[model samples]
Target chain A: MRPKIYLFGDSITEASFDDGGWGASLAHHFSRSVDVVLRGYSGYNTRWALHVLERVFPAVDSGGEGVGDGVVPLAVTVFFGANDACLPDRCSAFQHVPLHEYKQNLLAIVSFLKKRWPTTLVLLITPPPIDEEGRLQYPYVENPLGLPERTNEAAGAYAGACVAVAGECGIPVVDLWTKMQQFPNWEKAYLRDGLHLTQIGNKIVFEEVVTSLREKGLSLEILPVDLPLISEIDPNDPLKDFQK
Target chain B: MRPKIYLFGDSITEASFDDGGWGASLAHHFSRSVDVVLRGYSGYNTRWALHVLERVFPAVDSGGEGVGDGVVPLAVTVFFGANDACLPDRCSAFQHVPLHEYKQNLLAIVSFLKKRWPTTLVLLITPPPIDEEGRLQYPYVENPLGLPERTNEAAGAYAGACVAVAGECGIPVVDLWTKMQQFPNWEKAYLRDGLHLTQIGNKIVFEEVVTSLREKGLSLEILPVDLPLISEIDPNDPLKDFQK
Candidate 1:
């Protein structure tokens, strides 16, 4: 039985089930060695995700007789905090939890999971950037202020904060913000609103993860890629615009 | 124009708006030196309040308009993090941010306000406890592994985390949790849901804030009470149960 790779996050991960999300690409890319489980919610933040894990994960009851066989150790990747940034009223019903709190929340999850699965490797992925137009055309970027005037800088700070927290917790980080920024015309590569990624963007992120894993000495034989060839398609054909 | 002391928080502060909430009582208690602005929202957390401040405060723009005259040095007392503890799935869309994130979010607000009003004294209040059986009749407790367990410990932890963060930020904390825990029957003191405060709880929190202010050397003469008799009302009277 293949080990499971749990994709836990907000819309970015949840969007994987759709035609152009990274989850689909990731699943295809690592089909043989891992079973992918998407536990993404559209408009969730770190605080809420921690609650979900606290309530739902424990209920899964991975005991062989209860949940089923092939329920061994799993790799969990957490991506959250975008929607949390856009809350209308910071202290109203929702908290635009400061970056520090976001880090602590992530740490709590890592700490909790580490206790449960001592050897489980947890990966933290910083959410991608929201384009200048300020729409989170993805599932949820509620920032009423629109993207911060200094969005790249703000996004970088947020991602750096995530990396710092992950480093403090000894967890690995996949810096999606930097990787996405490297793309030429990233805004164009994004969907209309620029919060969610275009297919090319998702593919790039997926490849980054694969590259990171390979660099870490992890075997790729276990994770398989069964998706149709991307190379056969024209690179810039107007009809090839998958985002449309 | 009297100097304004804005009292912002969740239900405990919101209740003051009604005959039962301590806001009115506190207003009466400190009417001389301060003009208390009760901006309280029920079912709110630090996240939402920060959002509100971001939106509302920016409109109060402290720039060249000569506008924020009376509000320039406004003092704020923030009491929140109760509804945040009752999240069905902490990560769900229903609001209830996780504890750690809640703290960071609160700190962000503090930082933002401090930048706006460097001399403005901000008070951080950890809300009191809710008796699960009395006010909170729902499945407020977590039933991990099918074993029912009270989440009061988690709630307490959330409060403690808030205190820690506040302490780190050098903000004053009104320790409502410690004081409220001393009550004999906290559940009965609360309204039906065990989440919000009873009239008694609100009063106690209100007194604590007043006492904290006096301790800070703020003069009470400028803000004299209009109604001094309300505090003398018996907390045990059934007819006086303000939680309803």
Candidate 2:
């Protein structure tokens, strides 16, 4: 049986952006040896994903006869927290759960999953940085300046917290933020309005993630890249603006 | 402007049966002055709902319109924890969390909401008891045995904990479990599988809840019941076998 891998997180992991999402691309790279299940929902943060994992994943009575049965992915990848940082009510003082609390939520998920699937490799992926413009076109931004400065600070802190928590739990992390920063014109690599990544950006993310996994000594096979599909979305297409 | 009341919880408050959920029915009961938003998801426990409130509710960006400009609801009714009694993962040492922890989780939400909406009326509802057969048949039951024995005990303890915690937080609780026990043939009124209530069962629940609110001295108006359209399944339909 192929190793089953479950990808859980927010839109960044869900919107396989025309099949360029890290999860979808990772599945293509690993081919039959690794089956990936995308359990990503746009606009979800780590806290919400933890809730989804708790409420939805376990109670699923798939009965082993469903389309995705027996494809128990041996790995689970988690990418979240972007949306959490930007939510106004949550960021407000009264319910202001600092990065510390966010870390606790992430740790709880890791602990819960590790206990259930002791050997299932878990990868915690830090979300890519919000563009310098700071505007996420979709979800209707109330502030033209995009996310508040505090939110950005929180996002970065959240990424670092994820790394620390994952390290404490003995799980590996795919540092997408750090890796994506290395790209030339990192902001342009993302789609216009700047929240989600462009195709090339997603491919870059997928490559970095796979490389990290291979370095960890996992015998992950990389399938040939579908170049034609990847090139269809121009790196400079200004007219294709869609708010994610 | 009508007062905004947000009802959050599991199946019981969700009114899972064809009978309008408690939240919806409550909204109908207060049709003129209260604008109740039923934000309940079935199978969600307190832990997850806290996360949802943190992440999901905030992102609901109401475009600066609506009551309180989409801030936390003026009156938040929290009825959760039924599913929390279920084991989150196989490795969870305790199938159900200790009552102390459940109290902590419930208190966290109440405190957070209270701090945000200082004057927001927070209603903490104790869920109804699971019947002997241990199923929540209003919708369906995945586990006929309901929760393990220890879990059921923990649930009862959690109820007391909720009362104590709410009292400490200066919040009010509607003890549905205690009230439901007073009704003769409570089991028969509930769905055959046992966990969830039938239409009549829900009506009984609604009456108790309203009575509790009135006793608390809230000058809320209760509308006449229009009787929501329910599912065709009857609790005593002969063709429906519980064994299946």
Candidate 3:
């Protein structure tokens, strides 16, 4: 009866199971214990995610709200705002939400889930910094407006705002935007296209996410010891020790 | 909430998450959809497994009993008998449960699980036939006894008995014993040491497990279309179609 960890966010979280996605890394790391559920909605921001959360999660109390029907998660990583950070004038009009509202929406979402799963640990992940040069050329995510759609500076603002909201809400925050920039020429080294994570980018996020999790004391080191080490059990009449 | 599927077996199931294990294949294949719980206890046979079942699984009617705390799984794979097929006269006495008891133990395990999770699909996997020639060479599992630990003949008999029990229980069976032999020189190609699955063997089990699950109409195709496909959703407001 391992506890569940929900990865809730955008395309980054959704692609966690990709060839070398962070989700796969976590899955491999937490092999036999801790079910990692992916609830990432690609191309979704805080606004769209808020609309879809009820549908995605079952209600803790069915009270007609039809959400939170699933088992209570042990932890949830709410990683969003990449799409919300889309420059309103430059990017798709449909995806943009005012930065103030974006922060409020995140707080509301976190509060809602925390109310349902009081024991669940919440980790907020700010989207990685955008890459303007990569956006102008190569296989970047298509922007309908023909404009760059987002600049590293703008997305980084949303990332900072995300960390602020997480701080106010008293939850762990993985500031990938700031973290990825630590390396020189991080745009190509970390991100694949302008936005989505490459294998290396995924690794950076994975390390940061794991580091934050360890800081919160919900570390991976506690995983292996959680399951029954059957080989260590007494060979003959092992049922004695097998008893709870 | 994604329902769980338990990979219940010995070392084979235990190592299912190992780099190229079939369990990982299933996890990767059904990412974000099914919870593949690993309940593999190494070096344990059907006899020990039967003893540990109540502890490993939740008791249906806890009525005073403190078990049955976990979520009801969608399915369970009862794969055992590799060690049970050990020669009683020549191998480690503790592991060698006679073939007759092995069949009964499988039935008891199934009946117990069915009683708790009546709706859960049960898939019994017959152990891969032991490769004596391979076991004697290079790096096979150590056999403390001078005589070979298991014989293909004995394992095949248990496999036959397993299919028979499954037929009686109206459950599915993955007959690796017979299936592996279908390939020429399967010893080295399929069996890494002699008993456990090789990389190719894991693929074989993964395919068979998936095939049987599909036969039961629980294929991965049934995964819910949860996220909003930006292209599919109306550009203006797509929340209407987002409803179940």
TM-score for chain B of each model, two decimals: 0.76, 0.72, 0.88
Task: Give candidate 3's chain B TM-score.
Answer: 0.88
The pairs that clash in candidate 2 are A4-A72, A4-A73, A4-A74, A5-A73, B15-B21, B29-B223, B135-B195
Better of 1 and 3 by lDDT: 3
Give the top-scoring candidate (DockQ): 3
Model 2 C-alpha lDDT per residue in residues A1-244, reported as the tens digit of each score: 2345666776676554233455546654553244345555655555545654643345224453212222334667777766655534432222234576778888988887776666667789886766635454343324454444224455677778888988898778977667676767777765444567786777776776776677665554443211112123232431131111
Instruction: Please give, for residues B176-213, the per-residue lDDT of candidate 2 as tens digits.
Output: 66667677877677544455667666676667667766
Model 2, residue B212: C-alpha shift (Å): 54
Return the lDDT, model 3, position B226: 58
> Residue-pair clashes per candidate, as listed?
47, 7, 9
C-alpha displacement of B169 in model 3, angstroms?
A: 2.2
Q: Give the alpha carbon lDDT tens digit for every residue of B1-244 in model 1.
A: 3356766666566545443355545544443334455455555567666655643344233352211332454468877777667544432224466777888888887887778777777888875665545432454334343321224665687788778877988878887777777767766674445556655666676678777776665556544422212233232341232222
Kindly list the interface RMSD, in angstroms, of each predicted candidate in the order they appear.
27.0, 23.6, 3.8
Which has the greatest TM-score?
A: 3
CA RMSD per model (angstroms): 26.6, 24.5, 4.4
| Candidate structures ordered by DockQ, highest first | 3, 2, 1
Give the docking tier of candidate 3.
Answer: acceptable
Weakest 10 consecutive residues of candidate 1 chain B by summed lDDT: B226-235
